[model samples]
Target chain A: MAKTIKVRARAKDGVVTVKMLISHPMESGRRKNKKTGKLIPAHFIQEVVTEHNGNKVLVANWSGAISKNPYLSFKFKGGAAGDSLKISWVDNQGKSDSTTAKIK
Target chain B: MNTKRRLFLKGSMAAGAAGVAMSAGLLTPGMVLAAWNEGAFKAKSVDEALSALMGSSSTEAGKIKIKAPDIAENGAVVPVTVSTDMGGVDTIAILASNNPTPLTSSYELGEGALPYVSTRIKMGKTGKVIAVVKSGGKLYSASKEVKVTIGGCGG
Candidate 1:
């Protein structure tokens, strides 16, 4: 499958700022299908983890209230250029995807 | 050809088992992944959601900083950033007071991670965007009312 995550990590003054956009519907289970008139089942990212050089830096838990195609940005200290950063997410339906990026 | 086909079947079985384990809560990838507060996310009120996520909903106000728009043209995607300078920050949670399910996102910061988070959340209508920060084993919070011209959440 094609990667569902896009990440950008930049190191500045010992801090690595990471921004990521994940492709997901984030259906809240409250919206109804326009034609079918049936509520859409809730399917959203439940957990997102970020690792910096094999060390867990941030872990986020999200509800369906998050916007579709969620965007998250965070930062961590003590990171340098060329370090590997990994971002992954697990959805409510047990779907998961991960991608690794290098700090610039 | 038989050997290659056997390898394919073995790989698929492993993948299927992983999917089942993940859905059954038997395979938690990370320690923090178990912190997904289902009760908190399903809570209808802000206080209830907070209490479910944290032990208590009571918080010291004016310490955390919440950066969001005062007026949101689109409630479906309101950008919010919560940050604090307080040391020993453990967690950060964001909530939309007027949404059906108030809690939107919660974060646990690991060592070396800053006490900050930014994301976009949905709002059913004009409501207060609350940011609660847990630092030094205490909860501190700040909120800003965001006026919404169009309601989100399909309401």
Candidate 2:
């Protein structure tokens, strides 16, 4: 597991806007080791979901072609200030991480 | 000079002029240098690359939004997206502030396409994730801090 996942949500006109960033390497397995010349194994996040107040707002599918440190932002309907937004993700290695954000 | 002599001289002069002009355009030093430097998409950092692509520094924040995970378990495959509500949005760029090459990717929005993009990326460590949007010839940027728990590069 990486560090703490942080999410920030702001509500305006009954819409909740959320911003998030996940820490990952997104290795493509195409890189070679300098010493043994062995190809690195492929590892990257596969999917992500953002739910605002129990409603799905954004769903993303990713691949190894992405660069390092993936970030995303989106908006959903009907969330007031102080409501919570849940974000979850799964990686290629079968590891999963989730975090929550309070509407501000 | 006689008619034949004049005609021969004119023909030789025209041929020589054509050959010289052709070589001048095809083999000039400037032309060779231009050809060698054709690709101008290289950038050393996120800021430099964004400035180069947008022709200006980006604003702090406006209508653009960037989303990602707070703590990414892996660095190689972090998902990212940028969405904006502004009209006339021309381009969007994602930057990892702490990566070796921070400028991850950029997208040019088509006329009728949605002004949003989603992609994955790798991270070396915890850093600010930036999204820069180009609209109406001005650049706007927003960033969020992402914490990396496990090492993404090698760990």
Q: List per-prediction Cα lDDT, in the order shown.
A: 0.90, 0.67
What DockQ does candidate 2 have relative to the true complex?
Answer: 0.09
Residue-level lDDT of model 2, residues B35-146, one tens digit each, is 2211212455676766665676656677777778988877666777778888877667777888765665565543343467766666778998888887888888888888
Q: Give the per-residue lDDT digits (tens) of candidate 1, residues B10-86.
A: 99999999999777675553443456788899999989999999989999984778889999999889999998889
Docking class of 1: medium
lDDT of 2 by residue, A1-104 (tens): 66535677788887666666777776756567888888878666555666665665555545454765566655555678988778787666666689887899
Best by DockQ, which number? 1
Give DockQ for candidates 1 onward, in order. 0.54, 0.09
Residue B96 of model 2 has an lDDT of 81
lDDT of 1 at B6: 98
User: Model 2: how far is A19 from its true place, Å?
Assistant: 20
Name the top TM-score candidate. 1
- Candidate 1 regions with alpha-carbon error over 4 angstroms: B1-35
lDDT of 2 at A96: 68
